[model samples]
Target: MTVESPAAAHARGAAVIGPIHAPKASEIFADLLRQKILDGEFPEGQPLPSERSLGEQSRLSRAAVREAIGILKQQGLIVSKPGRNGGSIVTRPTSQELVASLQTYVRSQGWGADNRTLLEMREIIEPWCAAFAASHRTDEDLQRIRQRLDQASASIDRVEEYVSAGLSWHAAVADAGHNVLLSAFMSAASTPFLSAADHGRYDSLKARKSTLKTHKAITAAISDRDPQRAFDLMARHVQGSEAPLLENLATTLENDTAATG
Candidate 1:
């Protein structure tokens, strides 16, 4: 009537268990270093030990130590400096790096070719971001948004400049929302949106003017601290803008299918 322990039952071939795989030495070492960096034990701008020293301390070979460092470097946890005074230094990832990583991830997921999906994501996040900006934005945030808005207005006839300014304005709004992740995501999404717009249909003067009008209205709503107005304006603005882009994408896809077939 006695029940056997799981470990003992497994050992006696009476229990089935998944295979146990040990992590590589490099991964273990990398995890240790990553934890230290994140925990502030290894503060930013401080150089890590030399490869030989790290190898000695970790009881790993030079290759294994290098592999660990490489993993950390790739993860944006540390930077490698060359020269006599140079080595790996603990560092946090920059905003630009985060955007780059997010862009890579988006592309990997096949989201680049289909901008409707990206627009759908923006539709979900941006209205709330505008609402938050309406409630939370500071004078400096207002000024930044105005600056980009003015730039967009001035560059309405210039496709590249207009798109760039428009994206910057959206990013400013996201930043004003006081949400770091949303701001980063807005920045990351900009490049792909730009790529899609570069095909020329989105740069029509009429469309630019309409977009500018909506942006100005959205700005006004945020300036007046009207979250509902800001939210509605942004929602409509995004939906209005998404239509032409989606239509263009559909046309392009159909043309491609016809050509391929």
Candidate 2:
């Protein structure tokens, strides 16, 4: 029996997988530009070449160049300017952009409706964030955390206001942790919880008071630079909050199903 050549074997496998489509010129150009920007070849705040210039250098049409530029703009890698001497400017992506993109993706995936998942995420992240803040926090950070805690305490009786302040207090802790990615993720993950609160899914004097009490304790731990205490307090706080949050979510989901049924 004749042995199959490597080329023939590869061709057979390719046939099973079907043909690969070539990327669009715009996509290829956008990828190249993105790499250059990220690699610091094109420094932030520097103007990219004119569309006509880019078209000439890349051997792409003007429309393709424009499309590539638009792609970069959408990805938060660049900003476009109008008028004379105006073109795309290179820029680094910010946490706010990450927050927006993450929020969009989470919403699109129909996440955040399940309280259990959110609680799980919080349990993993917030405790560490609190612990980190204990070591990394500045006086300014402590001040901000204290202010947010006060706001949360004052607003405890009002569901919407309390939720807003409560979220802010959480955000302050994340920020004080000095971890940019975690802070952005926390900000994005908060949207659904805020929505739940807006609907008045769970509101009670007891729960609010409990939250404030735990928040104050966590804040004190961080302020005192006690990472272990901060971690423990935050973990306990998240764990304690879970039952009420989940119960309310379940009730809301049932009522929605009943109404829609």
Candidate 3:
């Protein structure tokens, strides 16, 4: 008796496989809608086709169309409202929620979203954000940024107020770049760190002054439309901010431990 490997048998035309069956109508319809939505045919906050119309167009039962819509909803592609003047509307998913989801996934994989990771992310992203804003920003964008800066400067000596203003300043820079996803990522990468530093670390006048100086420098670079300077200043600023933040975290933890002990 002779035996041959499956690969050899297939090459000798002794084995064959049939084509895969077509996907169900519900899936196919879902895919079509998904593609169009992803392609921006369905702009955010706009209504999708009515259920009756969709079913008619797809030539599928209402049940199948409903299933297809359910799939899209699960993927966060659409928001549905059922009432007078309410329907399924395309959604503009923000980076905050998306980044949060990804962070959760990272945690599930055993990577903690810690201070070190947050600082590293800022080191990587803040410079790029500053540079992009320098290149892409308009006069109106500059005005928006200046307003945040003014707000921060006015409350520089106030702890919580300063923190809120400073966060707004960073958000302005992110928005000036006109990249929504990057804006969201900057928020995600910095929020925990800023919250910790603001509440526990930045009590010193020196730290506040240093932060204000660096912020001014970064803003000046962007105002001058100097991308390279913007990048360099932001990199320097984020790096400089890390040490104080770590100290702040340590002090807060030590205080808690002492109280408990």
Candidate 4:
């Protein structure tokens, strides 16, 4: 029988005693790099170590290091340049990208309560966004908002059209805020609520008329560049609209429970 070297014996021991299901080397390296970036160990615009160096440091192959860098690039945490200074550089994460990823993740989780919570959170944030938009809106932005409002008003008889227009109007307000992050976040969060609002039993002519009036008032406040008025009107509009829907949902849920019981 041949005696194995100490290093070989240690390797055999590690194979038995180490993690039963360790992550792939590339994934492990990617996670380590991602944590380093988040921890500010790698500042924005700073180039990452060369693949060879990273491989040496991590005891991984060059291919594993490259794969890890590719993963980081996809996450918007780094970018690659192709030149003498060409390497992966740390980058600031864009809010749009972050929100998009988050939206996808939430949808994948198949959670209904998350959508409701998102709507509640938007109710808290979007009024401020509307107020900012009103304060800072240019003539062009106001004109665009007016066009959407007019379209919505004209389509009040058609539920689908009306719902589409309503969403557009809210989106216009968010766009007028001139903050991409705020706009993206509001747009994503409001999607399910907007769908729920559309399908609820609020499509009556009377409800349409009331909604139009409230929308008009809010638009007028925005057009007038009255931040306070716009904020107040938007807050009232959301609360007023949400109350009836919440009551209807609660009643429906109670009835369902009673019937089952």
TM-scores, one per candidate:
0.73, 0.81, 0.63, 0.69
Q: In model 2, which regions exceed 4 Å deviation?
A: 1-19, 113-116, 198-202, 241-261
lDDT of 1 by residue, 1-261 (tens): 996677888888885665699999999999999999999999999999999999999889999999999999999998988898999999999887888898888767766524767877787889999999999999999999999999999998888888889989999999999987888888877777776666554557987898899899999999999999999899888776346445667998999999999
Which residue pairs show backbone clashes in model 4?
none
* Candidate 4 lDDT over residue span 117-213, tens digit each: 6656666767887898889889888888888889988988988788778778888898898988778777676556455655654568788778788
Among residues 3 or more apart in sequence or in different chains, the pairs in candidate 1 whose N, CA or C atoms overlap within 3 Å are: none
Candidate number achieving the greatest TM-score relative to the actual structure: 2
Kindly list the per-residue Cα lDDT of model 3 for residues 1-261, writing each as its tens digit.
886767787898886664589898889998999999889888878899899999888789999999998888877888898899888988866566686765555445553334566666777788888999999999999898888888888988887778777877887898899898888776655455454555544678778777888888888999999999999898878777356455667998999999999
Which pairs clash inside model 2?
A: none
* Model 1 whole-model lDDT (C-alpha atoms): 0.87
CA error at residue 217 for candidate 3, angstroms: 0.9
Whole-model lDDT values for every prediction: 0.87, 0.87, 0.80, 0.80
**lDDT score, residue 51, model 1?**
93
Highest lDDT scorer: 1
Candidates' RMSD to native: 9.5, 8.8, 11.0, 8.4
Q: Which ten residues in a row have the lowest lDDT in candidate 1?
A: 239-248
lDDT of 2 at 26: 100
